[model samples]
Target chain A: MSDTTESKRLTTAQDYASLIDKFDTFLFDCDGVIWSGPKLIPGVREVIAWLRTKGKNVLFVSNNASKSRPMYKKTFDDFGIDTTDDELFNSGFASALYLAKILNFPKDKKVYVIGMKGLEEELDAVGVAHCGGSDPAEMEYMPAKDYTSVTPDPSVGAVLCGFDAFVNYKKYSKAHTYLTKNPGCHFILTNTDATFPSGGEFYPGSGAMSAPLVYSTKMTPTVIGKPNSHMMDAILASKDFDRSRTIMVGDNLETDILFGQNSGIETLLTMTGVTNEDHLLGPKKSSTVPTYIVNSLGDFKVLVDESK
Target chain B: MSDTTESKRLTTAQDYASLIDKFDTFLFDCDGVIWSGPKLIPGVREVIAWLRTKGKNVLFVSNNASKSRPMYKKTFDDFGIDTTDDELFNSGFASALYLAKILNFPKDKKVYVIGMKGLEEELDAVGVAHCGGSDPAEMEYMPAKDYTSVTPDPSVGAVLCGFDAFVNYKKYSKAHTYLTKNPGCHFILTNTDATFPSGGEFYPGSGAMSAPLVYSTKMTPTVIGKPNSHMMDAILASKDFDRSRTIMVGDNLETDILFGQNSGIETLLTMTGVTNEDHLLGPKKSSTVPTYIVNSLGDFKVLVDESK
Candidate 1:
């Protein structure tokens, strides 16, 4: 436990109810904060519904670039949570938004993608033209030492990297060639998460998938994910939200708590995901402490019971 | 061009002869110093054979790990240069030697390889049992989000990374899982060369291939290649060579010349490959200045002319 961070712990139903009442907007992170895997964390859906009933705005800000907004909606529906497409702001959408709005990417140029179909969908949503991602040609394993086909495409003005299950050397070589050979080519990364928890284990994340391109190209990507300020800037640009009245609730300290802190918003740490009490109280206390800590986001289900 | 570096330039045949006479042994980088693409650099063969006739030791020390020693020997034969298997010290062979001699890799445990057949052959020569390299299953495009097949194998004691045209997400997940789950698993890299010149263009190198695993696993590999001194250490342990009488000749300053400098030996830079005159005397002057400079190693053919 580090004395540097004085975090308030919510225990009773009054504390949970009081905490929710303070913010008009609540930002939730999906994986560990709402649902661990396939099942929804007990009481989370009830708490979210209760928050909505109180006219509180809720947004799901996730670093999971693997899923586009509509794909995430399906996951929400599968979990029996009523989440609309408009309330989600994932890294994939943020990346596309950054290219379309912030950079004002040329309409004629295309983005070389090193990601999944979800990322491509987001690019398409923003009317940003893209290539390579989830393309059957890019997924093919290039025969050893044959990179003649991996030449630079002049039409590619930017390289967008994210989570790609089909990440292969051909994609890396082509991305490297584009970033290196093409003048003024923007290197964009959805997020820099090292690993994503999947199927009861941590696998390579979107960041890991883009590491090779980063190494080979020797270019630093403009990360459009949490804690980078880009996502917050994008949200602020489009959505009308009072920053001071918003609270970010997530499981991971580095990604979630740090993101809120970077964006100048209040943050709540939930223990239902990647972090625990030891991370806040133990010898290796994380530097990024939250404004409030709770055993689980589901703890606020007591508010639902009170409503009944 | 920097005044901090007072390098001697060799021009005349007498100057080239004096430079070769000063060192009993020579370490040459293959790419630009010996050949460029499929064509052999003119006069390199004559210069090398002449150097051998004078009883001077010549070792081809290359960061190119795409080819094992035998494959390199075949290339040497194609170029009309008589280089024996023992005269080559590539990053691939250095990696195997490092594992067998320095680490004393356990015979029972296997190394999960993320490289090519050349890398596998080198590992085989050293008796390091390996899996995953060139495995057709590992190269297959794992249908999106299906990481169930990629599980932790306790038998994997080390993860050796090198250049693999077939490098895919399956290999990345497997390497990540092995390093994270397997206790005390060593991470090894053949070399950290960001790119390799092939077909007259630069492509992603061995280092880029392993970047994903390095990122996901959050592990620093023991790199057995140029500029790291691991290759020099391997050379010193296996061959009886005098450090004071050796000179490293290469085209690139970062990998080859810096490698020699790190090894406490003299370095000679040639102007036939990835570097040019501006690198030494331009606005973007490289910090790594070699001990000597030559227009090209083929310029040493002046010594051959003098002998004729």
Candidate 2:
């Protein structure tokens, strides 16, 4: 019914000025947009600081639940980027918020977690009860034939999953039992990233960690990360902002751009991360197109140049 | 294409007599048709012994790759069932055979394994050089932030995976590195069973174990187990049998019956384990129709009823 396919590119200082003038709120994705691995993208600090000077609400929306909010803030501090604690809303925090605020999880029931300590911290921060994650007992390997420990846990109301380095068959068996045997047990994931890029290659992500349960139980999980409206809601609850005056800026089309669209907002795509010029214009173009395009978020530095 | 869909049932002495006369060889599925867990199905011993007495070529085709040929023979010995070491063609053995004989894997290149000791034994039996599997170092867990240990290895020609209770981040990272970094690296699985039923419930199976790689790499591996023709070829390689004169006997229709159909052989469905009367004659009837059906493989013990 409407045209949202064409993405207008921002070039000159006038273009950047006009783009910034349209939105009072800006949501940014971290890994690819702000930095790559441990290396910070030049001018990222200048542009974000300029956004704060312009009285714009700058918040970081990250899908990585490998670290808690404080840890991410530490990363930002290490990068010398001026940002407050309330400016970050990661998938782990969103998932915890969904369970605590949106789902209104029964206080009596507990979550059977298949994730890292960061995810467990998020749940605790939200005042929700959880177990299994980072528990040495759950990490131990029972012989392949042993399933005696995989008993049905009636107390587990949800099986919350995220990235875990210790993902094993014991965790899968327990998750499978909870989903299959427990009545009305929810299956939730922080994000369904198939793999995460690190050490110049990809390793299995949170989605892959919980894949065994998905197969055995034939159940699809409610992903609480980018491209899902739940993450958007979590951000919205953090601060009141006009939806029309907000735009999501990131490097990934599948996650960032699609996420903005899912949240009923505009999106600005960048080429500094997983995407490139060919991705948007080549024969093998991605289906998830953004509302606007830019060479990189670093290009926003033009706004801070008084001479320009 | 004559229809091999409708299944005939054997009830009377004449029916059993005709059924035995029709097949010169019988391929039996161990877990469901012959036994359930540790308990052997009634009349299984009698039926197998009677088949041997009738000069029928008896062989076992199993998908459980957690055990090697010797281990499976030990299981048969524990149950007091009559079976030869060569009579069994498990998925692990099939996978090893596929790597060595079918694929003609280079002796200089080693396979990166993500499985248990049995799978390793099978690879060794086939004289295929391999690494990683059942290795204590691979079972150890590293910090979530550490990927320095996942450097690429050029010597790996393939990544062979099966069910492993000790599956952890190290094994996944290594497998991912070999598949992504190594050129022409093959991805092979012992079986793709989503879940294996045990302890009165289902647990993650071989397919579930490799799911992360499938999702991350966007590549499908060669599934060497049931419903795949590789298992059939492995069975054929072990013994001389006429496909037209042999029947595949099993309880489950999806794996066993489909495997038989893929092999261009007739299949006999049994109702002892996993499957029941309702499975064949219910509203949710399975699409994989067998050539013949029986209330139980034990009914074949009618041959032992001298009075009848």
User: Lowest-lDDT window of 10 residues in candidate 2 chain A?
Assistant: A1-10
Model 2 lDDT at residue B102: 85
lDDT of 2 by residue, A1-308 (tens): 45356888888888888999999999999988999998999898999988888899999999998788988899999999978868989899889989988889999999999888888998999899999999999889888657866799799999998999988888888898899889999999999899988777678888777777777788988999998988998777667899999999999998999999999999998888999878888998888888888887889787798634
Candidate 2 reference-contact recovery: 0.76
Q: Compute each candidate's TM-score over C-alphas.
A: 0.94, 0.96
What is the fnat of model 1 with respect to the true interface contacts? 0.89
Top candidate (TM-score): 2
Mind sharing the TM-score for model 2? 0.96
Which pairs clash in the backbone of model 1? Answer: A1-A281, B1-B280
DockQ (C-alpha based) per candidate is 0.76, 0.72
User: How far out, in Å, is residue A259 in model 2?
Assistant: 0.5
Best by DockQ: 1
TM-score, candidate number 1:
0.94
How would the docking of model 1 be graded?
Answer: medium
